[model samples]
Target: MQVTKTALKRIVLNRLYDHLRTHYSVSLSRATFVNAEPEAHAVDAATAFRSDIEIEELQRALDRIDEGAYGTCIHCNAELPLEDIRKDPCKRICRGCEKFVF
Candidate 1:
């Protein structure tokens, strides 16, 4: 199904909220540090770090949506395929640019 700009905006916003919630829940505090076992604390720390990155990226996507740039390839300024956006709403580049960048 072809996703509209509105849908993409909603998806990004939802993802941003979810990531922020998870990050906050997992990040270590003094209480958590005292209570968590070493291995579990380490794992939570790693997960929190990944969630932090995702939150940043998703926030950028929301900014792009507000700026009328969402779903466009950042490198080429082409409209990204709806399928690609549906598959990964946080993706900022099109498949073609993705090949060159990585």
Candidate 2:
């Protein structure tokens, strides 16, 4: 059976939880980056940046859902396929208008 939008939303919520956990993990503490070696600091910054992006994307997804625009391509207004949504509930653009993969 085809999955419903509510199910897709739940998937996004679950992923948001995972990203939040990673962003707040004890081992990835921001305080440790303050006195770490240059390489370690760089890694920490990169990790933090990635986590931030992930969290933002998930939040945007939730917003889009509330707007009744989830699974709709933001760039071209195309309807994103259910398969794509299943693959990534946070995706906001369709493949045709996609300029970057992340």
Candidate 3:
């Protein structure tokens, strides 16, 4: 409820766009770069792994949006700051719980 309807819409759109971009990156890295040189392949694999993580986060964000819990931390249930949401709409935990998560 902290975010206005208009802002929620914008956040959703941004998350969706980021999801698409990250998915494409993962696909490209796995397919086209899989047969590259040894060092390049390692880097591409790492990039793809990071992209996979991002894809998961984006999906969770969409799910939380659908459930009307987008701007709240899943860990502590604290209302996430609007600025934090603006920076990373897919964030699931607040800064406080973030330390323990990783």
Q: What TM-score goes with each of the models?
A: 0.59, 0.57, 0.54
Candidate 1's C-alpha runs over 4 A off are: 1-4, 25-51
Per-residue lDDT tens digits for candidate 3, residues 5-99, read: 44654564455444555555433433333233323554335444454666556556655666677788888899888778878877668999999
Q: Local distance difference test, per candidate?
A: 0.63, 0.62, 0.59
Expressed as tens digits, the lDDT of each residue in 19-53 for candidate 2 is 55565654444333323332344333534545467
Tens-place lDDT per residue, model 1, 1-102, is 356555676666555445545556644344444343323544345345564567667657766776777888889988888778767878879899989999
Candidate 2 TM-score, true structure as reference? 0.57
* Native-to-model Cα distance after best TM-score fit, residue 52 in candidate 3, in Å: 5.7
TM-score winner between 2 and 3, please give it: 2
Residue 15 lDDT, candidate 3, scale 0-100: 54
Off by over 4 Å in 3: 18-56
Q: What is the lDDT of candidate 3?
A: 0.59
